[model samples]
Every structure is written in C-alpha cells, then in structure tokens.
Target: MKDSFDDPPPVPPSERASLPDGLRFAFGTLTVLPARITRWDRPAARTGMACAPVAGLAVGLLAAVPGVLLLLLGGGPLLAAAVTVAVPAALTRGLHLDGLADTADGLGSAKPADAALRIMKQSDIGPFGVIALLIVLLVQTAALADVYADSWVRGALATVAAAVAGRLAMTLASREGVPAARPEGLGAAVAGVVPSRAAVAVTALVTAAAALAALPLGLPTALQYAASVLAALAAAEMLLRRCVRRFGGVTGDVFGALCEVAGTTALVLLALG
Candidate 1:
C-alpha cells in the first residue's frame, strides 16, 4: 500500500475554479446545479438532489427576467407565460416533463411496486404519461394566465418561488437513509452524500424567502401561497417515505416524480390563491 503522505494535499476551495467536464455534464444533465459543487466536495447522498434547487432557482430567475420584461413591454399574459414556461423547459432540456410522464405512468399502473419500478425504467412513454403531461400543461397554463392577469410582478415571483421550492422538497425527500431499488444510478449516488441537516436548513431558508417575497400579493395571499407550498412539500415527503418503504429507496424516476408532483402542487396552490 502507498504511504498516506504520498497522495497530494486536498484541493483548496479558492483553487477550485474549473471543474471537470464530466462533473458539469453530470450536474447539467440532472438540473441540480448547486449540488454540483457539493458533489465535488463529498460526492454522496447530497449531490444529485441538492443541486436541483440551486439549478431551479437559477432557471427560475432566467425565466422570470423574460416574463417581467415582456410584461413591462405591454406583451399579453399568454406571451409572458409562454416565455416563462419555455425558458425553464430549455434550461433543463425538458427533463422534468419526462419525470411527469414517468410518474403518471407509474402511478396509473395497477401493477405491483416492483413492476411499476420496472415500467419506469423503460425509455418509452405510455398512454398514461401522455395524458398526464397534457393535463399538467393545461392546468399550469391556466394558472399562469390567472396569475399574470392579476399582477405580473407577483406572477413572476410565484413562478420563481415554486421552481425553487419544488426542488428543495425533492432534496429533502432524498435524506431518509434508504437505497434506491437499483444498484447504480445518479439518484442512489445523491442519497448517499446528502446530510439530513443540510436538507432541513436549505428547505427552511427557501421557505422563509418565498413567504417574504409573496407579501406583495397581500398578507392573505402570501399566507395562502406559503401554506400551499408547505402542503405540497409535506405531501411529497409522505409520498417519498412511502415509496422508500415500499420499494426500498428512491430512483431517478422517483426524484423526477417528486419534482413534478411538487411543482404541480405549488402551481395549483397559486391558482387557489
């Protein structure tokens, strides 16, 4: 065996400027960018899911800028919503949509837990996935129409908040000390490095920020928005816990499911507001 001193000293944070292309590729593909930095440091449970909220925040900001600009420029509500939705889709390369589809397929399946997992691993989409995606798009579009028509600034804030919070919930779901059904996958890798405390801290911080920003919508509206996001997060955590119990852990498809469910739940809550 080589001596311990033979290895080079650990890389300092200041010198960690350019990451390996594979690191960026892994992170970009997952759409969990913040977790990318964490992956480099301790590459286990926290990496995959953690980066998601950070990426979602960045993507949300990118989408919000255009929506705000279009609204300021006198563009119609539909145009603004279109821009908001399109930009996020482009950023994550429609990965969430695939998750939405897979989740639908799995949930709609009457098969056993293992069978549902098997179906999720398939690359092809089923009728359930198709129907679910269409309905999700319809509901989100309608909600955006209402939100934008009411107040463009509020609409932008809510959109950004939902994106960030949804991913935050997914990260939280990953911390239950369970292994995914599969032997090797990004989801399993992420679950390994994620510290339970970090998940709580991040979720709390984002929740506080989102509630504060929703104030412009009015105290009642802000409370409603906060309640809605929390409800979604709670539901997701319950579902993830159940899935872990049933299947023994969360997979890439499960992570996707969590994100889609969380996002949809948040949007529906905004609509309720």
Candidate 2:
C-alpha cells in the first residue's frame, strides 16, 4: 500500500517550524493521532524515526491504562491481556499487523524479489498472511496473560517495554547503510536517514530506561527487562537482514513487520522471566 506521506506537498517554512518537525512526523505517521506532518523530507524522517520510540511509549501507556484498569476492577488476566493487545492494534489502525501479513505472504511466496513485491502490494491476504497474523496475535495475548496473572504492574511494564522495543527496532532499521527496497514510499524517505552512531545511542538509552523502569520490581526483574529489550532488537535485526536479502531492502511493510516481531519477542521474553 502507498504511504500516506508518499508525495506530500511542501509545507511553508513558518508552518513547518510551528511544531517540532520530527515529533509531528513521528506521531502523525505512526499513530491515529491528530499530529499534522509538516515535512516529508529526509530530515523530518530522520528525526521522526529517532522519535519513534517516544511515540511507542505513548501508545504503550495508553494501551496499558485500560488493561490495568480492567485488572484492577476484577477482570480476568486473559481478558485484560486481550484488551491490551487489541489497543495497540486499534491505535495504529492495524497498519503493523497488515504489514506483517503482507510480509509473510511475500516471504512465503518464494518468488523472485520483483514478483514477491508484487504479491505484497496486492490487497488480498494470502494463507501465509492469515497464519502469520493468527499466530502472532495468539502468542502476544498469551504472553501478556501470563504476565498479567502475576501482577498488573508487571503486565503494564511488559506492555510498555514491548512497545518501546518495537519502535527501537524501527530506529535501528533506519540507521546509516540500511537501504530502501524501492525508490518511492515510506521506506525510501526514512531508510538510512539516521546515523549508525545515533541509532546505537538510542538503543543503549532505551535499554537502560527499560532496566530502570523495572528496578522497583527487583534486581533480577530489572536485568530481565534489559535483556528482553536486547533480545527483541536482535530478533528484529535478524528479520531485517533477511528482508534486505530477500526483498533487496526495507519497505513500509517491512517496518511494520519489524515492529510486530520486536514487540512480540519482548513480550515473550518478559513472560518467560
């Protein structure tokens, strides 16, 4: 599918400077919020991708509110988990889930890059896409359920960590040297826009923050949180490399897929801990 900002008209300098360009780009494109995107160039994308995790943090907090509320009000862990999982999907308008499905279809097709890309662009969901979505949602819900059963605080922390880790994957994916799969669309605009050093710095900061957030739970929990974030990023890197090799580079769909992969990985790791 074409990105909403694929060919956005230029915004006047005054309008562009009215809001922080990076944040506007981040929330505008990444969520169903009302943040207006004032710029669509590489500069905005660089800042947007760097701020992606901030957006994720917001989304995670929003999602956790209802689930935590439900658990506090006598709701079962399973139902609360389902709501927590559903909120993020609704907030993003299921863009990442759609991307995950499309990516699955493309990878499962086993066709040439061109043909697979064509398959991914189609509006219909193939068997691979259906199966991928089903499994991912199930795993995410189940992991959250287990965590929520332990305690609402841990569950909320897990949800936020997963959300942030997902966007952190996007930041790393956009680091210098990563290529876009096509010359047009979201991937082209943001791919390789962030410097490698900056991406690393963001990763470290996020990992530290995750550990610190869980510190009140215990030292072991704090270490587990940090490890989960790292593991999530590692999983995303593996998938990013595979997608680059298979499709030649990243796409909006690949970005979505990466978010889902990283989020799911983080939740699973947290549940295990």
Candidate 3:
C-alpha cells in the first residue's frame, strides 16, 4: 500500500514566476484552453472570476482564427461566420451554451423561484431553452456573417470585442452585490466576489483596449465598438436582474446566460456599426 512518505513534496509558489492565480481560475472555469495551475488554491479561485475577460480575449482570438482562415482561403462569408461561432463552442465544450439554455428554461417556466430553479437544475432541456439557444445562435451567426461580408478586418475586431464583452458581462454579473441563488456551486464561489471598484477598473481597461483595437478601422468604428460593448453590458444587466428577481440570486446558469446574451448583443451591434 502507498504510504504518506511516498507523497510528493509540495512545490513552493516562489519556484514559479508569480503565476497569476486569478488568471488560472479564469481559464480553468471559463474555457477548455490550456493554462497550467499546479494547485487549486481557493483564494486564487475566488479572484479568478475577475480575470475572466482575459480568458474571453483568448477565446475570441481563437474563435476568430477559423473565420480568418476561411477568409484567407476565399470562402463564403456565411461559412466563415458559422466557423467563427462554432470555434468558441468547440473550445469551451459548449458549457456556456448549455448554461444559456438552462437559464432560459428556468426563466421561461414562469413558475415560482424554487420550481424555476429546479427546472434549471434538470439535465433535460425545456422548450424555452431550446428556442432561446437556437434564436441567439442564429442571430449571432447572421451578425457575424454580415460583418465578415463587409471585411475580415471589421469581422475580426467585432469578434474580439464581442468576446471581451461576454466575459465582462460575467464579471459584472458576479459583482459584490449579486447574491448566489444557491448555497453551493459556481454561484456560491463567484457571485458577489468582485468588488465594485475592481469591476469598474477592469471594465474601463477592457473598454480602452477595445477602443485601441478599433482605431485602425476608424474613429467612427471605434465608437461603434464602444456601443457594441455597452449593448452587451446592457443585455447582461437585464439577464442578471431577471435571475435575481426570479431565482432570488445569481446561478452558474445565469452567468452563462449573461455571456451568451452579451456576446450576441455585442456582435449584432458591431455588425450594424
């Protein structure tokens, strides 16, 4: 039998280059992308949600690769858009999509909070979830297609902005006042974890980065990027409010819904831009 003496020695954090724990948790929880975090430190996990935008930026960049490749190959815009939409889902194992569907089901049930939450917890998809997922995906794809049709440059920027917006929505939804609907799980771990000041700072940085990215396109386009981000944040606010009112607090599914809605809204707005 294995003995306690056989256990490996613990590696000190000093041996590492001050690896960002918040970033680790962000990547671990937000995407299936490769990020090494040797230890599952609880304190780090608590702050990780704040770094979700960084993960989202990675997701956006990777997701854009498919469309960018297709464009470089002279493929149809619709196909490129479809590929872009599929890449993030593929990378993340569709967890966010599943969450979006579940949250929709819960909210659409129109039942009391307990019954609604129970519906959300079920492994099966309800009619509302199915319809919501389908509609959101369709809208996002169509928007992306339109953007790609315009130019790959515009499309890429929009995709990145949308991706960042989605994570930013997750951050906003998890702010200090947002309560967890349940006593355990993701909601318990992340909801209300972000300080309001931190949220504002992170959001401002994201917005500034997005603006800088849009500068190459034009000042008007940069304004559009800002608008797109705002639209996403607004959608997230609505989703968060609904979750709070209906479920009495935030849930993991609610966070998922915020990401989807935020991403879709950002894409649509950017397409218009």
Judging by lDDT against the true structure, name the best candidate. Answer: 2
- Model 3, range 1-273, lDDT digits (tens) per residue? 122224323445653223387787889888988776644543565467778899999999998988988998989889999999998888789888999999999988989999998999999999999999899999999999999999998888788888889999998887767788999888777877666766778898888888889988899988888878887898899889988989999888888889999999999988885
| Model 2 global lDDT (CA atoms, 0 to 1) | 0.93
Taking all chains together, each candidate's TM-score versus the true structure is 0.80, 0.93, 0.91
Query: Which residue ranges in model 1 land beyond 4 Å of their true spot?
Result: 1-29, 32-48
* Cα lDDT computed for each candidate against the true fold: 0.69, 0.93, 0.85
Tens digits of per-residue lDDT, candidate 2, 1-273, equal 233224434445653322388999989888897898988887788778989999999999999999999999999999999999999999999999999999999999999999999899899999999999999999999999999999999999999999999999999999877889989888898898876767878999999999999999999999999999999999999999999999999999999999999999999999997
Candidate 3's error at 43, in angstroms? 3.2
lDDT of 3: 0.85
Q: Which of candidates 1 and 2 is the stronger one according to TM-score?
A: 2
Worst 10 residues of 1 by lDDT: 1-10
* Predicted candidate 1 versus true structure: per-residue lDDT over 8-50, tens digit per residue: 3444565332334324533565564443333333342344455
